[model samples]
Target: ERLHSYETKRANLQAIERLKDHLISVQLTDPSSKHRIRRAVSEIGKRLSSIRNLLRDRKLELDCAVNAAENFQDDLKKLQKFCEQTEKAIQLVESATIFVPSGTDLDYVRLHEPEADEVANRLEKQWKDVFSLGEAVIDEQFGIVSFDTILEILAV
Candidate 1:
């Protein structure tokens, strides 16, 4: 189960990386490429949502295990590390910029893509979903079931 969680995260990170590359490539090209890039970005946003949900579920499982254990110090540390990594991953996507044409007297360009606005909104929603799960894990740690229960459920 832990291995599955790691694989899920790896796949998500790869997807994000691919999206970043596509965005960068589009930025380097002409304005006509915006539509294609926008589509790619939208697809990436959907992938991000799926990945976040997977991670959130795994996080809950980890939280349950931690709560059931006698010592929470190490588990707490791991949780902190995971939180930091997650934040970094989100920041990576948030920091990505795309160029757009500026309509003004002065010769200037917009830094972020207008097409990405909707994608960003979707990404924000996914982030909020994952954050809610994180909050629930923290608040309901003791109430979560133990590994034995999970194993039994899996067995059936």
Candidate 2:
């Protein structure tokens, strides 16, 4: 059961990474939006941190539930709320158009984006609706190859 939950969470993170790529790659159409785009990437980092915290907290709470001899109702409710919050946050940042900042490193994006094509395609197949027009970021070292991301998009 936990494996399934982790799988869902992984997908959500993948989608978010793809969105980050799109924001970096496309925002270059306007040179003035670079700062705003940079800030948006920073905001994406915050969202990613929140998602991970929610997952970790849920797992800890589940452990408490398992150890309890009785009255696990509250733990279960908290877990449910965590799940809802995770999905809500994912939906909030799933689209680049909604959050991409105006100022972006267009020159950097043009040079590195082609390398992301394959990974982006795989991510698209995995979560079509969530990843708009973006490439899958395949970084072997947990590094952001094209965009500014808090976490690396490990090629899955």
Candidate 3:
């Protein structure tokens, strides 16, 4: 879940922050080395902040998708009820007024929407299992993937 990712990122960022603070506390022998360490800490903090933002975005996206699916089901149900009512009115009213001897022209096709909750849940579960697949192709950590690695996998 995205919550787990947020927690993991929080923990890692906290650990990094602790290391940065310790680095700042210890008197570095070289001024240049101290400056470099501070810069590294700043960069790591920025990256962690970005990850936090991305996690929030993903959570919002998933929530929206689920809500849309729920709304879709509700609308589908309303449509079914409306059609049923129309068909019933056609059967009762048309037989008396229009003087149809046999059946009416309306076709009440029975349609059932599959469990929207189950479909959404299944997609979320599958994505949870498959989330790591994209990470293999895009090593966002280093912004690089070796061609040799790709070639070896392709050979497989």
Q: Estimated TM-score per prediction?
A: 0.26, 0.30, 0.50
- Candidate number that wins on lDDT, 1 or 2: 1
Better of 1 and 2 by TM-score: 2
Summarize candidate 2's per-residue lDDT along 43-120 as a digit string, tens digits: 866876797789899999878746651333343344334444444444444545666633333433444345444444
Off by over 4 Å in 1: 1-32, 71-156
Candidate rank order under TM-score? 3, 2, 1
For model 1, what is the alpha-carbon lDDT of residue 144? 38
The Cα error of candidate 2 at residue 149, in Å, is 56
Arranged by lDDT with the best first, the candidates are 3, 1, 2
- Give candidate 3's TM-score: 0.50
Question: How would you encode candidate 3's per-residue C-alpha lDDT over 1-156 as one tens digit per residue?
Answer: 767877887788788878877877788546777788789888988887887789789889889868866865665455445445545646565567656534332332222223433444454444344445664344544332433332232222
lDDT for model 1 comes to 0.52
Better of 2 and 3 by lDDT: 3
TM-score top scorer: 3
Give candidate 3 regions above 4 Å deviation: 89-156
Give per-residue CA lDDT, model 1, range 129-148, as digits (tens): 64468554443443334433
Worst 10 residues of 1 by lDDT: 104-113
